[model samples]
Target: MKINKILNNNAVVVKEDDQEKIVMGAGIAFQKSKNDVISQSKIEKIFVMSEGNKKFQELLKTLPEDVIELAEEIISYAEGFLKVPLSNHIHISLTDHISFAIERLKQGFRIQNKLITEIKTLYAQEFSIGLWAIDLIEKRTGVAIPEDEAAHIALHIHTAKLGASTMENTMKHTTMINEMIGVLEEESGSTVDPEGISHQRMVTHLHFALNRIETGEPFHDMDPDMLELIQTKYEGAFVLSQKMAQFIKDEYEVSFPASEVGYIALHIQRVLERT
Candidate 1:
């Protein structure tokens, strides 16, 4: 194999026997350049992305090299820790997720994952891998990832552990989240700045709320006094939550807990304030 392009010190684009491949290993591309002969023993992994998976190719091009390296390392840990081979789709999905997450953090944005407890309870091994991922990321990037983000990573690992059925459900949940966000925007009489942290927080809230409801996990009880305060003070936000709750019942045929509804109102109030 010969290096066609260096993605980073640990990664390279190469060609072997007329096939283009992404090869990675520690320091494999160190001081190396295009057309350099690659030592076969140094190649740890070869990503032979199918031509049909154009998104994977695009991710390869668009992802920052460190994020690529970090995601691969995390994936490797997840597989080993879980003792299972994951869907190749994770190579694209998780890498893209990490890239965005890192950029979001750099921009001083934090997305809270309300699903953390359920995730820890249900997917312990994957959660462990998520913890490991955050530690490694902090060491490399000097950014401390919140525990909630670890749970988020665990969900990604768990999803990638299965087949199309699980992926389909995940996609369905994502679509529903987008619709719920649209409803909130309409109710608040404001368009969410898609790139803003407030938007991320709202989306995260809705996404986890859906997961929490469907999984039958217990939601935290909102304080009665504080809840009444918000209901009275942020009346519009409370209305927004009520409309969203009704939408959930009408569309998904499920009802969010009253506590969850209160949290939704708080999230709505925050977004409205930021907007």
Candidate 2:
């Protein structure tokens, strides 16, 4: 493919199959002009834009080579552990975030993530991988990132998985889920085992419930008879669900309708039965 534009000495934009891709390598674009054919042997990495995103090219041009390399290593490791393909946008977003984070740490600007606990509780696997990433970043870059960075990294992974626009909403949703679990535990006078199957189901239920709330979609419709039956049969769970609904409304300023209460009550009942 011929070079369509030059981003830097090591990177250039080229068109292949009528799609623009930014190609990068050591001295790949050095002394090269537009329309010059890039040698395959000199190519190290190629980034394809998702939905014509230009941020990746901008990041590749600006970020330090080592930072980009480190980000790639961490993402590769996460993919192996997750056993699922991640969005291509992860490379851009994560590299940009890590590069800025490293700069901030260098300047002695430390910011703690308030949602760290929620992230650890709700996304244990991703948070664990994020902690591992922290060690790897320090070992490779000699820059010690705080544990809070793990939460930020985990949120980045979560955002990529969900194709979300911002981390703020993801954190808010996580905090909501944690609060819901806390309410359930408080009502039951016991800690919910996060590792238990019931807790996992509750987490899943809360995730989708929050999503629907955010999108202004109605919660799953419950049959009137089933709702009443569940309310009577699982009185304790129904009571806890009421507390949950009120907690959600008070904290998030969003109403949790009765239809959702029945579904949430079922989840609570399952947890109570299992425990």
Candidate 3:
């Protein structure tokens, strides 16, 4: 591909397939001019923009090279762990976040994430990867990142999976799930196993439930007979589910529907059986 614009000594913008792509490598653009053919052997990473080239180009211009490289490495590791291809925008979002995080640390300003516990509980795999990312950052830059940053990193990864532009909704869902799980553990007197199938089911159920609640979508109608039977058969779990419903009502001011209570009770029953 021919160089369309030079970004730095190690980075350049190239036109490929009538589209602009930001390419980076060591000394890849040194002494290179516009319309010059870039050497394939020297290219280390290429970022194709889905939104536009302006913001990404600006990010590359201001973001430190080491931070960008760390973001790429973290995304690569996350993709391998998740066994799925992540959106290319993660390269931009994650790099910008890490760069700014480092700057904030240098300025002695640390922001605490209220959703850290929720992020760790709900997105265990991604959160574990986030911790690994923290270690990688500390080793490379000698700047130790707090656990709160891991939650932020995991939120970025979760947003990438949905191809979303912001982390607001994701953080809300995570926080709600965490609070629900906290209620479950409190009532059951045991910690819920995040890696268990039961826990996964509960998380999936709550995820969709929260989505419905957020969008004001009504729950599917259920048979009153079955709901009564579930409540009677799993009385303990039903009571816990009631507590969960009340928690949601108090926290979000959205009343949890009765039709969904039985389903939540069933999940709680399964979790209780497992624990």
Give the top-scoring candidate (TM-score): 3
What C-alpha lDDT do the candidate models reach, one value each?
A: 0.79, 0.83, 0.84
Q: 1-275, model 2: which lDDT tens digit per residue?
A: 89999877778899999888888777888889999999999997787756535987777778887887778778878877877667777887899899999999989998698667667767787898899999999998888889999988988886777455466788778878888888889889977776778878788778888888888986668899999999999999999999998998988897778989999899999998887
Order of quality (TM-score): 3, 2, 1
Which portions of model 1 show Cα errors greater than 4 Å? 52-62, 171-250, 253-275
RMSD of each: 10.4, 4.6, 4.0
- Worst lDDT 10-window in candidate 1: 114-123
Better of 1 and 2 by lDDT: 2
Q: How many angstroms is residue 81 displaced in model 1 relative to the true structure, after the best TM-score fit?
A: 0.5
Per-residue accuracy of model 1 over 1-275 as CA lDDT, tens digit each: 78887766777787778877778788899889899999989988888747633466667667777888899899998888888888878888889888888889989998787545445555568788889999999999998788888977987898888652375566566666666777887876798766566666767777777787878888888889988998999889898888988897899787988778888888888888888
User: How many residue pairs clash per model?
Assistant: 0, 0, 0
Better of 1 and 2 by TM-score: 2
lDDT, candidate 3, equals 0.84
CA lDDT of 60 in candidate 2?
Answer: 72
TM-score of 3: 0.75
